[model samples]
Every structure is written in structure tokens, then in C-alpha cells.
Target: MPEPDPNVRLSNAEREALIARLQTATEEGRLDLHEFAERSREVYEARTYADVERLLTDLPAEDRALAVPRAPAASGDMVLEPSYTHLKRQGAWIVPGLIRVNPKYSRVTLDFRTAEFTTREVEIAVNLEYAGLKVILPKGAHAIDDGVILEGGQVINRAFTPGGGQRIRLTGRVLYSRLKVRYERRFLWWRW
Candidate 1:
């Protein structure tokens, strides 16, 4: 099929389809909530066919209605999938905008105390089964766990409240697992 011209005007139906693709990517842990909102805004503001196509370049096409082909690989997502192992991320690490965690029979720790965040809002998509996941937020950072679905699981938050600071949103399913959100304890000369 011939590639659509970049300057071709976009129809309302095409715009809606692009937005739907963004929503699907968010649900699949490819895009965070903040990213979704931003891209949705772009979709509404988009005028040309290329404008809409740019938003979906990194996402796969699950439906044939779009007709346009996607790039072979999707970027900008960090996935952590482990089974029967222990994974820890701390210190000076770079936190991407989206993190997808799927762990089974494992223990995972994500400490954002000294890490660098590329965006003010981050989303952690967790799909857990028989696992233990601990997230240590930086001081003054807010966290929301409202989007998580628990099936014989727990989502515990020993962290900051919603206020003027960085925000982290957790989503996805937790089956027979435990997800804990807390802050790093600070001492006089060290952190715990």
C-alpha cells in the first residue's frame, strides 16, 4: 500500500482511532497515565494525517481499522519481568516515564530516592502473582494506588500525601501478591 501523504488532512474518525490506540497502549503498560493524557491532547490538536500517525508510531496496531503499519519496535518503556528471583534498583538510576513490572514468585525493590526522573509524573504498571514488590519514593513525592486491582493481594502505602511534588501512579493487577509503597527513612548521617 502507498504511504499516506503527510499533509493530508485528518478526519474525526482517524483522530478517535489514534486516541483509542493510545488508551490501549496505556492499558498494556506501554504508556503511562500522564503520557496518555498528553498524547490525547495532541490527538485533539492534530490537524494532518501525519500528526495523528506520529502519536502511534511506537505502538502496535491491534486493529486493522487504522490500516497504517506501525514501526517494528516500541520505545520509551521500561519493562521488568522476573520469576523466582530478586531484583533491586536503587542509587543513581534513570527512571523512565513508564515502568511495566510483571513478576512471579519473586521479590522486587524500586528505590527512587536518589534516582533521576525524566518526567514529573511516572506510572508503575504492576502485574503480579505470588510476588513481593516494594517501592521507595523520594521525599515529598506523592503516590496514588487507586488504579490497582487486588485479587487476594494487598496495596500498602506508607508514603506522602497528594500535594505539590512529583507524582507516581500505580496501576494494573495484583493476584496473590503484595505491593508496598513507602519512603526512605532519613537519619542524621545516613538513610534507611
Candidate 2:
């Protein structure tokens, strides 16, 4: 693989624009977070303007200009499969089986109690962060907001996940009771 370009990196504004476009793909369930991140990182480290332009020149053209770059069904393109697993309902609490998050996929899930006539399953996305995450802690407790602060200006704030990749080993914590941290990616669709 080509080494990332540090000298010709994207500006914050340009990076934000690219991310915004990627968000469109994510919202539409077109590009899973992990894939989005991989593509994003590649784009971010683009060395030449031509490379960046070509990279984004093929974004899906459809109703929403914000649509994520569809996997070019060119045979070599990878297919996206479902990433949800079963949710364990242990009395009042709920939990997922296992999840994985990477530069190609990230997801989020909400855990809650369910009433009769319903069973819920979900996978909370944590890695491959596009948007931030929001966390609500119980009463009389507190926690910090940074997940893993790296040295290369890369911050893996588990608190700001959009939720729904699969590989999950990271998360954010909100210190204190009744605390709601406004993260970027809040997976509201996750439930029990």
C-alpha cells in the first residue's frame, strides 16, 4: 500500500468537508463506519491534489449529493453484510454479543429494558469514528470523556461514536450523575 502523505495532508476545513460527505454515506447505511474511516484516512493522507480529486470524484451520484461513495460493484468491490448480533436480555439490562470496529466499519447500539411482545438485538459501533458519541451515566457517578489520546493529533474518543461496526473494545464515560455528554455520533436507533 502507498504510504500516507503527511506533507500534503488535508486541511481541517477540507477534511471536515470530506467527512461531511462520508457522513451522508453512513447515514444512508451505504458505507459502514469502518469502511468510511479507511477511505477517509486514505483521502486524508492524499499527497497530491489530483489524488484527492480522483479519490472523491466517484462519490455516488443520486438523490442525495451527500451519498457515500458506493462500493464500485466492479467485482473487486467488497460487499457489505449485516453486522447485528443478538442482544442478551438479562432481566432489566441488555447487552450485545460481540462487536468489531476498525477503519472500515463502526457502529453504535443502545441498551435498554424491553416490555413484552418484543426482543431486541443490536451492535454498538465505537471505532472508525465519524461523528462523536453521547453517553448518559447513572445517578451519583462520574467519569472522564477522552477515550485514547494519541500523540499524532489523533484522538480516539470512544465517547463520540456513531454506533454499529462490530468489533467493539472502546467506549466513553461520563462522570457524575444525570450527565449527558453531547457526542458527535449518537446512535438513537439502538434499543432493546
For residue 34, what is the lDDT in candidate 2? 82
State each model's CA lDDT, in order: 0.79, 0.37
- For candidate 1, write residues 1-192 as lDDT tens digits: 566777987665466456656766776799987898798888778888777676676776553225634321223677888667777767655677899999989999999988777788999999999998999998889899999999999999887497676799999999999999998887898986
Poorly placed runs, candidate 2 (over 4 Å)? 1-9, 61-192
Top candidate on TM-score is 1
Each prediction's number of clashing residue pairs: 0, 37
TM-score of each: 0.60, 0.29
Q: Write the per-residue lDDT of candidate 2 for residues 28-101, one digit (tens) a residue.
A: 88787687767767756765545555545456644222232322112221111223421121222223333233
Q: Choose the strongest candidate by lDDT.
A: 1
Task: Give the worst 10-residue stretch by lDDT in candidate 2.
Answer: 72-81
